[model samples]
Target: MVGDYQTLKNIIEQSLLTALFQPIYDTEQAQLYGYEALIRGPSNSPLHSPIALFDSAVEHGLLSELELICRQVSIETFAKLGLQGKLFLNVSPMVFLQDDHPKGATLSFLEQYGVAPEKVVIELSERYVVNDPELLAQALLYYRELGFKVAIDDLGSGYAGLKLWSEILPDFVKVDRHFISNIDKDSVKREFVKSILALGANINSKVILEGIETEQEFYQLQELGASLGQGYLLGRPELLPVKILPSVLTTHQRKVKYGNYLDKLASSVFQHAVSFDSQTKTGAIVDYFTQHKHLHSLPIVRDQIPVGMALREEVLELFASPYGRALHEKKPIIDMLSSQPVVVEADTKLDEVAKLVTSVHDEQLLWHFIITEQGRYIGIGSVRDLLKQLTEQQLQQASYANPLTQLPGNVPIYQKIDDLLTKQQAFHFAYFDLNNFKPFNDVYGYAKGDSVIRVLADILQSYCTAEDFIGHIGGDDFIAIFVSDNWQQKADSICQHFDQAIRSYYTQEDLNQGGIVSPSRSGELQKYPILSVAVAVVEPDVERCRSHHDIAELASSAKKEAKKRCKELGKSAVYLCQRRGPDGL
Candidate 1:
């Protein structure tokens, strides 16, 4: 497209290019996550499009020179804009192997622009597949050592595929948009997306769904559990500074929601358990315990397997007796081990272990529980520590409970989400809110509004099991975290029950009229529909959600859709953000 090599070289030398930025949004937080820097050639020239410009550079043997100039321009322009988030700069793998590749140039530009290394994510597109994996690996390692994050762009469509993903575990992966377009109607595409999500989860990589152009596609991806997304629908690339859209603002605000309670294990809570071989002398064991007063019990192990436990009180009591030290000081520690020591697997739930300690009828034998991994001695868990952990957890739960409804509040809900994310568990986050609730409150007063809220809370609790988490997000908003497979049925039942029960709150005349006559905000009289429940369900991709914030954002978006549906239909609505699986079929 360009005149010749000299012209291409002149373009690079004179920096005849500029950077345009597209924002990447966090589906959970509904905030601007970062901006991706895209390079453009002169607007009046044939090289205006990046594709044509790059092609021209490749033909002229000036690809590396052009790429370096683009990188430099992007860095300078991004800094001038004073962007608040990370800057994603696209780089080709081939440039890394170039002899004249500006090594440390990026770091210098960052310093010149006052940008932090952590705020930059080096995006490697699959277009320039690395012919030498080892060289690319070395280059990536070098960049990582300099504190820059790495991302793989156009992941599924690229030649790199799974092999490159495995060889160099990137911090993020951008899924090609072909899998996202019309995903709501394509079953096979949905399955493929699901598998990619699973693979991302397996590798702990954040997957960003790109090229979304429609509302259905965006919401469907959000429903499928994608936390990071970039598309024309979310935002379009522009030269201006980042400004969040009104739709994004209304959709992203997080409300408290329910999540599964994390059941911590004894092994996870206690880390300072001391153990000794059975042959160790009683005198030495006593000395060790005396030096470590924090230890309440000691485990006697044989071939890494815990055989018995020595209760501190019993050992101290034995030594306290008259001439007790003289009689038993030199004997093997195994001689003093309790005959019926309590043993528990490392994976045993903390609650179960607590029961074991409390069930001991003999107070003298109530001591530490020996923790084992695969039937081998790992450590000892003190009764005191177990009780302490339980008390702390109870206090935390109480603090996070909504006083009016006695449901879990925001903190617990967030903790539950975090726990699920850490364990890579798949679950649904449902946000339920009362439509036209404010109008009802204004007309009927606070007491009736409170009664309505309580009724809704009761219905949610009635349908949910002990395994599910129910939370009150204050006022008429509620949340339910469903871990079971029958969540759809539960959601349906909740909506139906609320729809039928809400009619009782209104008088016969109001019911017949279908709504109530209320004063509009501008003092004009208007008809407001009766209160109805709307449930928005978001099934987050485990791999994409980094924190509870991500899940909360997606749930908020779903809730908005549900509320919209209720406004149009004048009835309770249940909307699920659609998710796709790995198998396209």
Candidate 2:
């Protein structure tokens, strides 16, 4: 074979290797999550494929060298591309433990490229069994200490198996592609993936399905609630960073729409119940329940911590018998209390709470759940109230979500902004819209036009922090509230990614032409360029923009300026409104 030891050595010395990037998508967020850097030998060479290239290196005793080169080149190329999101770089366990391996070189390259360690996931293939598990574990700990995330690759098909998974407890586990192929029709594969997902959830690890090549596989994975995915169907390895496709975006939006209808529980729905000290006599509770007939349940607390609950029916039943009141009235209320009620944290989901309540076969279902903050009783939630709130939320989500993207509509957006303002919190409100979107709609028809909107929505949702809020203001208009200080960076990233992704929507001829011919309002033909996003950022002064209307007005002004700037510069742009001083606007 031409790819022998000598040829491999020559290739490494000449630096004939290059890197290709394939994107990984977060199905839940429907955004471009990150790219995995794949190494390749020179084109038209016998070592073009990675298998041949790496096998040769292993035979030549230069595997460590080749891996180092791959990493360095991958980092350099990724940085040069100015790609957003994480970079998944593969590392062989054997190569990783070599004495001559470049341990510090990775961190050095990242520093040189200004790439954060947090943005790189060190992917270790489970196929290579580690000779020194302790050393590898130490090395992995070092990587984690430096803020690098670790992922186990080819999990099910490898020798490492559960032993390695248990020992490492990696941040991510990549399911082997064999299970992902034709997964929609393979019940065995689907169940395996589901089990993996459950295991991942239990360990707080993210499961990334690899080598996805079909729409059915992707949809099935999504249906199984797999979050991270990478495969040819999502994107093929390319010299440059890959953008998420419109179809993926649309699928994500559909999933989100369905998820919105799922029941959600909010602690606010629980009513504030009167609580009595555990030391109080039964007579006091009897008198309170007698006086307040509307109270159904009462929390019995000790040092502000709920010890148990007293249901109205149980307490009233005791007083019904002539001798029962005299027999137990002098006893402490704690003695008469029912078995400790179900205690749920303020943020527990209703479905989970329902499960907990129903787990007991007895009459506990009728008991009110004690809601607590930091283990201290705050309120009580009845089954009726929980059911009602869940139904209301479902109805509200159905009505309040945008039909196209299924994002929260304008009403919720306004309410969120108003809530932040009421709390006197600082937030950056951004308005996003597509440049030359109408012409795109006219040329591409409604289906394709909706795809563009969904992409934008996905981008916003993906880039935003959990604390941030995203809402569709209808059609091409959208709003995002950024509570993080890095709002400008996020806005710029959204614009940049949108610009890169929008090109895929157009034909090669149209892209080469830089614009398309479409009819104007007067029935005359005009050239309209491909779609670009314009973002308007406004960091409202708390005192000045006291209402959602005030913030919207300022954002609208900034949006106009941003659109104007885009037109002038002939590209996407983000314009921030000048901030007001602390004194006043």
Best by lDDT: 2
Q: The CA-based lDDT of model 2 is what?
A: 0.82
lDDT of 2 by residue, 1-585 (tens): 537777788878888889999998877666778999999998888999998898777777888989888888999999999898899999878886677876688999999988999999998886666767777777888888989999888988877656767898999899999999999999999999999999999999889999999888888998898888989878889996545444665446545644544446648567877789999999889899899987778889999998988877888788898798889888998988757688888888887887777775548436678888888888888878777776776667645688777777867777788898888898888899888889999998999999999888877765775578788888898888999899989888888888887899999999999989999999999999778888888888876676887887788778899999889888889898885423335
Query: lDDT of model 2 at residue 166?
Result: 87
Which digits, one per residue and each the tens of the lDDT, describe model 1 over residues 369-437?
788878987777777778888888677664576666767788777878899889999998899999888
lDDT over C-alpha atoms for residue 334 of model 1: 87
Measured with C-alpha atoms, the lDDT of residue 160 in candidate 2 is: 62
Count of residue pairs whose backbone atoms collide, per candidate: 16, 0
lDDT against the true structure, each candidate: 0.80, 0.82
Which residue ranges in model 1 land beyond 4 Å of their true spot?
1-3, 245-249, 252-585
What's the distance in Å from true for residue 415, model 1? 21
